[model samples]
Target: MSIATSPLPPTEAKEAAPFRPKAVTDFASAGLNPALIESLVLKYLLGVGVASGRKVAHELGLPFGPFPEFLRGLKAQQIVTYTDAAAANDYHFSLTDAGRARARGYLEECAYVGTAPVPFADYVASVEAQSIATENPKEADLRRAFSDLLISEDMFRMLGPAINSGKGLFLYGYPGNGKTSIAERITRCFGTTVWIPRTILVEGQILKLFDPANHEPIENVRSSLLREDDQDDRWVEIKRPTIVAGGELTMEALEIYYDRDNKICEAPLQMKSNCGTFLIDDFGRQRMAPIELLNRWIVPLEKRYDFLRLPNGKQIRVPFDQLILFSTNLEPKDLVDEAFLRRIPYKINASDPTEAMFRRMIEIFAPKLGFREIDQASVDHLIEHHYRRINRPFRCCQPRDLLLQVKNYCIYNDLPLEMKPEYFDFAAENYFTVL
Candidate 1:
């Protein structure tokens, strides 16, 4: 198969020295049971053949306190031995025949051997600690989040309460009018980050939670709510996630996913999006029927909690902890009945820009395209001749699209980047060719 399924390169055999934060000074602090940690340690040794106690802790992404004591016990039991005796607990450790046999048994059952999975209970609890309900974003927060964007006071007023409520809203309007862009920026209001485990354990199965595409890592994070010393490295600190699932969003993707052969499970989309924003971009047009998608959330939307079943048929409750946005170019009334609409109470329209707003967008974007002196007369000329004559509605994206055409026209003619009525004429003729 593909390169992603190929064998991963072996991690370092010897554990490197890593500083421990005060948050996780012991196994209890890491929120893991002793037996679970031991299984991961043995499985890793089975794969690597040798690793130091420090390395084992580091690789497991656990605190060092419990490892030293656990290693001493394994050493006493003749399951493992320190290859070298050093004062710094730097003995390169290797497993004995007995330890390898035990590791083989562990592998036969689950086969998870990388970073240890955080207990599922701990995961649920952490979500509650950082739930979007706990966040109260102010107008200043929204403004700061969307400082560079062209959002009006009316739209901001509508968004402020909806965001503060941390509930679902419909951002319906024409395409390319910044519904997706607005959805993307909703996370910035909370402006705080939370810690999530890389892998969550559910009944001996590994459920990977951290996704690089959705979760951005921060160093020297300056959020007051989640301190580095408040949680172990087992949990990675990320800005509240803004997960956008477009037309490809399926009902299966919204549930617990398991690969029996691989012995791995994937956390449902909502679990990964906890304490963040989950925008169903192009919501009504998803592969699954709009009714089916809305039905799945009926209970979760009201109770603010969801239930997912494990492979073993065990139903587990997880926090439905994100502000859900349904962005669509289609009319909301045409997509869902009144009952569904009521559940999604706030339906805001991101309609076409007014003439003044359109001009402002052109003025703001023109300088970035190397035209510092944007000809006001040329802009007026384009609006009067092109838009008014044709009775065309101005879209927020038109300025960028038409300007690029002007830039290209200048480039092909060996001319400088300047806004002129003649250039707008060329841009409009070429840009509106389809119409």
Candidate 2:
């Protein structure tokens, strides 16, 4: 659960109309049948035993419009009766025997009882309005996203156009060269935040969308604060999502995952990553073969939309409107065919750092790793003996990783936290013992 709570960057002059889901003011605007809403209300009451009219409405994320008035209709039919008055002239209501039986039936059908789901149509509209394809990131945006890393000018030039393509690219080369790090930060080049539904209602089925493990919510932040009830609560504002799937990825993960006992569904990874970025890390080493995964995404890559079948076998078209990055140690040509390679326009190699760049990284990371300062002699000794002697290539990650090993050794031995030639030798001896 990566949390991106940073303030959004300045918008470009050509920004499109901002997307905001207005509070649904009626049953029609909610796009849900009244009977469905009624069933939800009853199920909520059955679970809690008793709650205020306003509490129920608030729990359901429908505090506006005729939702309260509809509750009165339930009271009129003796399904619910007022126990006591609540704040703001609301009433404490409890379910009758008939209501409890009905709620049990509804539970038997599907037991989901959290935030009300936004209609599938509304969700589709939101994705189109907030798609990353509309974004045009300039050099400044790329620099800001990669501010922490040392990006060479040539690499920056290659990355800017690739990010702007929004179709995605392959970040391929040697391992430990920051391919994953670069892929993770690419989303920051686009807009910082976008709204997504907590859950989606499609064809009478509820699909959970707001995964706490993937989406980070931005509370009380909105485009405007003038109106108290300006935006819909059904939708949550999240830091533009960067969903990463590495070696553990499987074919089942690409489709709608249904929980039989809960009678609930979790949206596919790509669906949750709409309007943001999806990184397929360690691409060739997934649980499934590379060709199988590539075949699954061929149409979505070309069409910018995907078709996913529901549990009932009905196929639904969903927007595939995210930057799909594939990060791998293997070469793009070796892992995928030319046809597949053509789909991904850019194939930027994350080459190993030059000797000078490697030393620069050591200088930058030493103090951050709690070393007071580093001497030139230790760096030279490290490069000359540990690297040159073994004919070892320089990796962008070696500076930090090797430094950590030295630091840990010093801490264990109660020695001063300073880089010394002896420490580098000790660190490299242990570090390079493995492949």
Candidate 3:
């Protein structure tokens, strides 16, 4: 299928450019039913009571070509009447009694009244065009994405190829070792932004896709008031998503969610994370068994497509093109059998940091935590007394946690923001007691 593409050139340096969806002028080009568009106009008019032709078109995100002519046909049917003259040769329209009744019937079926949903076929094409598998992250891209972390050279080298693979991987180790953090940053290596439909329409069911909580929308700038944007407003430009699902994830979340009350459908978690990354954080800790969850995604992980059943019992295939990262505190072998393990090709251990790396973390975090200076003596004292003496293994998160304790103590005791050996002792005593 020939899909419409945006004319805007890529602005991001080095990152893979995303495929932008361009504006469509007619119902056929927009992949919308003329009958459906007419119903939407009436519904919108019923809601607001009175609105201009341009306003109705804008609200529906169908701002160009033959839409005004289409609205004129409603005026002929006596369903819409002109209330007042609007600018740009348009008129304010209100729904007649018959029109309101028709809209009420439409609402009874489904009350969706937003940007007309992109057709499912169009959404599938967008995912394939912007698939993460198409992008290859060099060492520079990895370094840029993970610049904030203190990753050792060996770990850095291991991550690049896995990200390049674009299949899936496991990040397993003990807790507080940056498994989730690493998974979240993996999307940055691919690109900065991608385009997704605000909602998708399949067999007349609206599937709400663009989520403000998970997807951050980038607003479009108009070049002039005389001309509308050439790009499709139905598709939102968003930062490359890194959707994290943890212990709260349920088996139901991996499928289509139909809201019986609203008569609308919500795209599942994997659908929301398309063209980017989906991090299953605290993987083994979810309510479902690891094997069950693995079974659900086993086919999609390899085939790069998924099947979802609508409330009407009709099945549809959607592109499952995302970098899946499974992060857990438990070992991979303990979570699933060898067959499942083979699917997730890379298993990188988030091992405990060396004493030197731990010290570096302390040095990096000390200043950020309001310590005026790092005392080499105080750090050495902290390591020797708190860690070495107790035979405590160093976790990557200890520096930040220990420093917060010391900082809070300084505030409580009205002491200077200095890293004193005594402060380290106090912090270590309180911080390590539970762990």
Candidate 4:
């Protein structure tokens, strides 16, 4: 397949350039879907076999016949070349220089927009500054780190005041109301390198300490700064201290472990989460009792600091700088008693959106995913028929999900990219439950 043409060079320098279409547009121009191009890039990077036309079809979930056409398009763009003549008739593909560049450029763009890669040591220091500043003017550092993209007007007001008050934040709402999305987005506000402790084998023993930046083993790390002549030049130092833990976190994961060889204890999750936001998503659904989790966190949550004792009877007071966000769909009263709830300084309810909001959200997501137009009336009809008729709460993610289903259906049936009422019927049947 031929590769797609590149977009024009960037016109102006930007602090953060908007996403410029290069490979994606190139493939689209050659009659391949942009999403298919992305899948190809991912499959190639993952080293999955892309040798047979049938295998490519199976892997990409596309029709078998179209695989040759897709490969031809890629070849035309010089993105891939077949090594053996026999492979030319098959899907055996390899990246050309231009193809590799396109893949790397696309990833760089994603990382630029999504993650802020900061040196591990600097990230730790910033988290400390943000946490300490929470009581005063310095709190801006921490406050800015927790900003969201599309927060409601009420939430913006509540969040700022609540954070300054040094109170915990509580976010609750119906499922698919963007509660978890909003919480996850907060991490983007900070520079990279969330501090998380990891288990490392030092001297043939497992000891958990603040993992060094860049996830390198302790033994491999250079102990001191070296001059050019003294340097081995074999290893490059990089710092990555950002830590995000969910799902598998236990009380033991939040404590110090004794490292007999190093004579130091491993730092727990709370310690690693310092200076970063610690989001407790699906708040009431953990295996641990809600009261137990709340009680364990009460002292540190209130004081913004915690103590950990070493095996040899030494203790260290670590700064608790993590901005804790509790996200749940369960009712506030059901999740915690009034007394415990009060300890959480800020409460933002991520309620279901109004009809107007839902419509706007659809309009926003439609064009991005190749939905040329959304039938507002059709969407409203479904909302009224499927959701309102059944007394289900309006969900923000519904539009995104519906668009995905429509896109998938179009691909499955080889239909033109258009939003039809049938798409909603399909979505409703597959996704929604009758109330």
Candidate 5:
């Protein structure tokens, strides 16, 4: 199906870029009907004993289109009986004995009662509609994304094209540089949020897609200004998700997670990050071997879609529509062979901050910490005495880390927060304890 996705040029970052599913006002537009969703509402009512029809609609994140009628139909069949009309959409309903038995049967099969899930076909259409690779990020967008962080113009130039690729990129550099920080801010470049379903149904199995901990839901204030006649609450608008998986990422996490006991299916990490960025932080430090992890991703990265096996042993294809980032302190060469690396087109070096850039970072950060403006003297003192004498190279995090130490020292000593050579010495001494 031809779904309407916004063609967001890099300059259009300020504009809305969500996959606006049009004309989704009624049960038909939602891609499911009363017959499909009513059972879930019945199961929900059985679980809670009694709830309003509007409350049921709210809980399901579906419209009352044909649903109030569906409930009335249940009442006509003597399966549901309204106890009272407390308020608008506040009619309390309860299931009859037969209804309870049927609800129990549904529960025995699977107990998922929240949000009448969007059909898997709709989800796939939405993903294709808002593919991250389609965004053409301009230099302005990059600047806006990293405006808070002290990024050099050269670094911005390198990052603009790499991030625009939206395929995959290796952010490799020393540990203390801004690889993680850069990865974190990559989502800001798109400056757009997309719609994602909380749950998806496929071949009688329900896979939960939206993760509250990971997906930050954008509050809908502009829906009141839309042309679709109304908003489809089933589709949640979330920030272009930036899912960061660190050293703990396992091979199991890359595939669909089926609960043998609960019989529920949770979407893989890639599924959660559709139309956004997926960062594999501290890349080679994962519990699994680097080769094994790289090999697992070889298909998803290339095909831009993933194949997942359902509980019924049926395989399904899901859109791999995210910019997968691998951030590592390890050198890219030592980690993966050429064949694997070939799939990931862009590899940008998060090189250590230059001395000038390092100083500027301090100047930028010191004031933000409520300290007086840092002077050239403090910068010179750090480079000449602490760095040059100790043979220490500058890292991007040092300025912020050193300031943090100085702030703590000032707090303990009851002194004003300001940058001084002595404070630098104290901070550097403690900060480089391992070195």
Candidate 6:
């Protein structure tokens, strides 16, 4: 069950496509079928390029001998190209363009089934409106921050309609433009429940129902059977699930791996992120290419479900009911073309804050970070000294960082936390760009 084989050829010519079998029974009743198995294998090959046949076999709970035959079948269809290292008795498999298309098609088909609506009766109704008794100070603080920015109500209104339409979002701007902060605020405002796969060993066998094509977790199925009286307190809480992964996500980290003793392969990030928000923060900056990432998600984003295969040749469909938000500082035109951009419906541009908002931010953050006396005179002086004189765009971090530096200076010098010209000079020198 090791996938440490050598590289396979990119493609083979004059090969016929492999036959894709259909399931005889419902996915739940039949457990796994040939089509599901082929789809899962295809996903792994596409995601990881060439993996070890033995490793693939173990993960799928299939006999190791059948894997080479599967690889041969895939190779014959020209979906994958295989290289046999007779010396090592290892066969490496890589997906061709046709293979990739087949895999994507399989995943797209799976996504539809995964996104099937759950029974409404299973959900309990919580208080819709906020009450004085239940009001949280943290929420008030967030509201205050939003109010201070004076963001147009029209801009805010677009969020609901866009999400309701089940379209992806693109948020872009320069650094310090509050894009990340706005994403956090959206999550806080909507409330979010993080959905992680519920894995358990039943009869010494691992069963996962989090497949995007058929997103039926054991918990979801159990919840459906509950009586109304038994489900009074079990309302579906609307909480946004936020997953930030990119710089840390490697090719190996995105696929299934074989475990010999347990005889199982675990689901990857995309599968775990079902029914939640998957935020690709600092998009176009991951180790993988932006096109590669987009290609991986194209099917799921379009269809709202994904099919993932187990190492043992079992394909599982999972629901993809999550808000996907791509936050980047790079220009959209530079990163992706017009054709690709059309797939993402909501494009929110977050620019630098206005001077009034900037000044207010300075006043609010400065005092809290121990700048005890930040009068309007000192604030204006700092702004004029750094931004106007040096011709640098005002950064929100500057105010917050400058306040921290001033506090550290006060503690070191045994002085009160007062905003002086000296502290401003230090802050301006270190944080602001001088012309």
TM-score, one value per model: 0.88, 0.94, 0.94, 0.57, 0.91, 0.57
Question: Candidate 5: global Cα-lDDT?
Answer: 0.84
lDDT per residue (tens digit) for residues 300-350 in model 5: 888898888888999998898888899999889999999888988888888
**Candidate scoring better on lDDT of 2 and 5:** 2
Model 2 clashes, total count: 0
Residue-level lDDT of model 2, residues 79-149, one tens digit each, is 89888887767779999998888889999989999678899999999998898998998999999999999
Superior candidate under lDDT, 5 versus 6: 5
Candidate 5 regions exceeding 4 Å error are: 1-18, 23-29, 33-35, 86-90, 222-229
Model 5 TM-score relative to the real fold? 0.91
Least lDDT summed over 10 consecutive residues: which range in candidate 1? 13-22
lDDT tens digits, residues 312-356, model 6?
Answer: 576555555556788898987777766668778788877666687
Off by over 4 Å in 1: 1-22, 28-31, 85-87, 220-231
CA lDDT of 88 in candidate 3?
82
Lowest summed lDDT across 10 adjacent residues in model 5 is found at 222-231
Give candidates' CA RMSD values in order. 10.8, 6.4, 4.1, 20.0, 4.1, 18.6
Candidate 1 local distance difference test against the native: 0.83
lDDT of 1 by residue, 5-63 (tens): 55544353123322222366777766667777778888899899888777787788765
